[model samples]
Target: MSDAYVALEGGSVVAARCRAPGTSHGELVFTTAYTGYEESLTDPSYEEQVLTFSYPLIGNYGVRSERFESGRVHPRAVVARELTDDVAEWLTEEGVPAVDRLDTRDLVGEIREGGAMKCGVSAGPDASPEDAKAALAECPGMSDYTDIGAQVSVSAQKTYPGDGDADTEVALVDCGAKESIVKSLVERGATVHVLPYDVSPGEVSDLAPDVLFISNGPGDPANFEAAESLVSEFVGEVPLAGICLGQQIIARALGGSTAKMDFGHRGVNQPVRDLRSEKVVMTTQNHGYTVADPGDLEVTQVNVNDDTPEGLESDDLRVLTRQYHPEANPGPNDTLGFFDDVLDMVDCRTPVAAD
Candidate 1:
């Protein structure tokens, strides 16, 4: 007999095995990535969401703390066809709900047809369909979580010294940054100062950083007014860079508009093409919003599948942004050069002709 019940927005209740006991609610979304379960689970971008693994078996390689992106699991709950004991135990210890032994293929199909929607999960020996439905009824939509940044970002400023000589300084506004992003910059000889999401412009000006970076985060871009304000404040003054939601925030601050995607890209092998060179590369992505209008920035690259803006750059303003993750924790290393491009902007203070 099933010990877990999942209530979807459409009124359908799916019975599943209880891997970890708890009750939770969030927006239900799926990821097609076949590996990197550990990194994906810890990603701050998964905040306020129920993550469903499209792959059948998860935790084949067991779990390790070194593979974690953040200090804790970000997803409110997890759904899968089968979850190994290691992952299940980890989720239980983290106080996050986990349910498996369900027809994930069918559930994924439903999400594709209906888009990401509100979901509720009730798991444990005493779990009931009514319990899950009750959670679902009370669950707020993603946009309604106006204070989501506070849930994932750091409360105080922290700094990580660069690995080597530490030539450049980067002031990173941590909306919800991944540890890998810090490591990536440190490895590149950059001293990274991670600041709070709601930090003021005066606080940033105190640092006098060579580059102002906005880290990837969760929730609607419009909600991160502080990060957007930072973007506007330092647009022409400091070289700017961002990734994932960082890209969306930069666009919004510069008069660009962002809209919700039907089902945002959440996988390892998303193909992106450069408009200038027409070169293609696979990237890792996890976002529910897309840039609709680029405002003053020039579109440098786009997703091959839907032609959405994937890379936004402005040589004049020394601003660079990407809609995909270039840190390549669980994805391809194809876009690692993105960091190089962003760091290069430090030397290009004066505007140059678009190449």
Candidate 2:
């Protein structure tokens, strides 16, 4: 075992064992997901964040390419109580920093208490904890840092043919979206034109899509001015939807507001109750900020644990949004009906995304 250290923004450091050697910076955060390490590692939502796993034992199942959420790893670093050999090798091969024998229980507790903070990790097997803490001064804090959505979003327009009969035409604003989000739509035969984060109203209107989708992405939703601009142009004129950061954008566009969570939800099993269904279903979620108040909008769902807004809708604007991931790649599909509801709004005669 080599040396590794997690440095907090407050200038404290935790000593640990280094599985991969490197120095990296990100917002110090944790995920409660016990499985799906591969999906979590590649999820665009984890971008620029040093992830701490609450599951004490990790990587026992080994790495599998089929489970990847994206083409590559997204988290800046990995921390855990025990890192398996397979995960360590994969992290080392990918040039990502990772550490084990790190007191993750204490780390998660601290983060939960203080909220996510800008931090750095150095995994040199003989790294100095103090040195890592000192370097934290140079790293950008998550709140002040911008450019997160742009970093993960698509830069060009690409169209994918629907796997179904191609009845519904959908325009998706790729604000750092996950692959499953598109797959969920395309599987139902919806022609999807994936656009960039800064896509103009003209570009979207040119598609003449029956539905407009704003996707989940990293960083603060406030940083995504262009997405908000697009929302302003299309709201009330088109059937629109958003997820995660997309949900936050809709809130802002509709006169509501977003606020950073004390510690954002990043996990596979979150319970949210649908106001319409009166049923609580498990969901997947990842976001540092949440809609504090969904102004003038009907609250659709609420997180059972925290009472935070999980879903919002505006029948007037024909828009619906969920702050959790309903496309669930590595999570349960209980809330997949949200997508079916969106497709229904698209006038899809058939119930889609039911799987």
Compare the candidates by lDDT and give the number of the best one. 1
lDDT of 1 by residue, 1-355 (tens): 9999999999999999999999999999999999999999999999999999999999999999999999999999999999999999999999999999999999999999999999999999999999999999989989999989999999999999988875788899999999999989988989999999999988887877889999999999999998998899789988999999999999999999999998899999999999999999999999999999999999999999999999999988889999999999887999998877877887865321222
Q: TM-score per candidate, in order?
A: 0.98, 0.95
Question: Each candidate's lDDT (Cα)?
Answer: 0.93, 0.85
Give the clashing pairs for model 2: 2-125, 3-125, 164-189
- The candidate 2 region of ten consecutive residues with least summed lDDT is 346-355
Model 1: residue 59 alpha-carbon error in angstroms: 0.4
Candidate 2 contains a number of clashing pairs equal to 3
lDDT of 2 at 119: 90
Cα error of candidate 1 at position 353, Å: 26
